[model samples]
Target: MPSEPNTYPGYRFPAEVIHHATWLYHLFRLSLRDIELILAERGVVVSHESIRRWCLRFGTDFAAKLRKRRPKPDDTWHMDEVYLKINGELFYLWRAVDQHGVVLDILVQERRNAAAAKRFFKCRLAGLKYEPRRIVTDGLRSYGVAQREVLPGVQHRTSRYLNNRAENSHRLTRRRERQMQRFKSPEQAQRFLSAHAMIYGHFRPRQHLITADQYRRSRNKAFRTWWQETCVPMLA
Candidate 1:
């Protein structure tokens, strides 16, 4: 028999199986039952409940590892806040992405006021080693208010049209939100989206900007990084 991964030593399933289910759930947006069906087709019988548990335990840790290994984000940040309908109540999801569309951080909050924006800015900034050179956001007024205090001296550009990089970042998020049938609460939204953004973005290079050959090479490297972070004894 093949060896099980050291990284997942205590689990009944091997790291490969657990990681596969995780990738399917996060990277492919497949539900737990869908992953179960796929695995069963290949003669591995595991319940969706087990897969769900596996994801909850291991997926976020893997993403955090991946996030640490990523190069520092570019200096220009594009930030935005989107309305989330959680539990039939309105909430705000604040997000920041670098010019390359690499997600910086995400925050779920009860409002989009200046205080809420400051909280988001501070939280996002706390994770980074460096501050942004500039930030572009919609003309929310709150962002401007936050910038004066939390991000003083950084070049702030407020325009509805100039923030397409940040706005376009929400497309996948919107899709995932729909698939999950909307988040149940602010905590749930914050916890799941933070992991989901990192995992999904790690695999998805900007394919449109690169040649097909280049895209393949970039993808191969990303998968290698994924394995190095999640698998023990490494994958050749």
Candidate 2:
């Protein structure tokens, strides 16, 4: 992996503090004001608006670093689309996850038709750098239509019950939507959800499949990776 950038020359706060606040915001369901209050308790007097700016500026960089550290996704991809309300306008949020529940890619679009599905499929294929062996979806004919165009030879399964992994992955997004009261625009929703997926996917493991000791080890490793990715080292 490439080395993280060493300096935030113009920023008044240390990179450690800035990145920590960003991590807290995305890793947990905390609002900007909530982060400000938490920092106040720690004797850091930064404003909520600053926290928001830090997230907007550096969230994607942190997420990109985390994505580099992730393992290659599984070949069986599960795809789903959910409707998001922005300014009382309905938009489609398309997401795909691997069998292990790692998010592959996400896109926000105005429709859920074949064109939208094809765009989403192309996005995932380009981002992940390969086609999946099998793609599963919740009986969406658009998925079938798109797959035939973009991934003609890949296996496509359409079933309501087989795509629970992708459906369940939306729980966090739903919580965040409720907390934010709804997104203001399509661009904002896309940016936030893309970064959110990478950060959340980094820390989330299949807890039910692992023993306690293994789970603890996994959690610790995730924290260590987060620290390395986000913090610049102090001078000697």
- What tens digits encode model 2's per-residue C-alpha lDDT throughout 1-236? 96565557788887888988998999999999999999999998999999999999899899989988888888899999999989888999999999977788899999999999999988887755677899999988999999999999999998888899999999888999999998989999999999999988788888998999999999988888888888666333
TM-score of each: 0.94, 0.93
Question: By lDDT, who's the top model here?
Answer: 2
Local distance difference test, candidate 2: 0.90
Residue 24 displacement (Å), model 1: 0.7
Clashes of each: 0, 0
Q: Model 2, 137: alpha-carbon shift in Å?
A: 0.6
**Candidate lDDT values, in order:** 0.88, 0.90
User: lDDT per residue, candidate 1, 1-236, as tens digits?
Assistant: 98644647578787788888888888887888899999999888999999989888887899899989888888999999899998889998899999888887999999999999999999988866688899999989999999999889899998888899999999988998989888878887888888889988898877887999999998988888888888744556
Q: Which sections of candidate 1 miss by over 4 Å?
A: 1-9, 232-234
